[model samples]
Target: MAEQGSGGNVIAALCCVFFPGLGQLVQGRILAALVFAIVAFGGYALWFFIVPAIIGFIAHVWSILDAAKFRRLS
Candidate 1:
């Protein structure tokens, strides 16, 4: 992937807007993608409760930020 704030990062972040961890998957981070998907979707599954919903929201936002800020080690 490109550096932070690059076009690729921008696209990745945008992808996250639709689904948490989708950006990570685009960025080639399989583990992170799975983890984010599980956490965010899992929390969302329990939306009946307020706390889980909030946690899901936070995870969704965090995934977007993480994708946007990701920098490959050189």
Candidate 2:
């Protein structure tokens, strides 16, 4: 996969801010997007506890950083 530029990545990361997996989807990482969406949303849905909330937060942060730093193939 081609890596996106820093600017693009920033935009992608911003997208992730709205939805955890959206960044990955914008970056062309469908699987990662799905995983993030499922894990975060599912965790929150399955258990309305602190643990799940924390996990979702972590996933959200990860998505942002990952998108910002993600490198794609030229």
Candidate 3:
């Protein structure tokens, strides 16, 4: 994943995939931005299948969070 200033947002991205809100919550996005994850998943859940939406969220959250944690060390 791409690293950010430090720790990146890897955790957030990971959480997004499985629990979208988790990563944003971790990044301290004021709970509002996370709403997008829900709306996004909810909106397209039917088209992509609820489970996949969850997976997608997880991937995004993970990538972000991972990048964060990894960047710090880098």
Model 2: what TM-score? 0.83
Better model by lDDT: candidate 1 vs candidate 2: 1
Off by over 4 Å in 3: 1-5, 44-74
Model 1 per-residue lDDT at 5 = 93
* Model 3 TM-score (2 dp): 0.43
Quantify all predictions' global Cα lDDT against the true fold.
0.93, 0.83, 0.54
> After best superposition, candidate 2 residue 8: deviation in angstroms?
0.8
Please, what is the TM-score per model?
0.96, 0.83, 0.43
- Best-fitting candidate, scored by TM-score: 1
Q: Where does the lowest 10-residue lDDT sum fall in candidate 3?
A: 65-74
Error of 2 at 9 (Å): 0.2
Question: What are the per-residue Cα lDDT tens digits for candidate 3 across 1-74?
Answer: 34564333655565656654566566656554466565556645655566766665654555454434643233
- Give the lowest summed-lDDT range of ten residues in model 1: 1-10
Candidate 3 residue-wise lDDT at 27: 61
What would the per-residue lDDT of candidate 1 be over residues 2-29, giving only the tens digit for each residue? Answer: 6989989999999998999999999999
User: In what order do the candidates fall by TM-score, top score first?
Assistant: 1, 2, 3
State which candidate, 2 or 3, has the greater lDDT. Answer: 2
Q: If the candidates were sorted by their lDDT against the true structure, best first, what order would they fall in?
A: 1, 2, 3
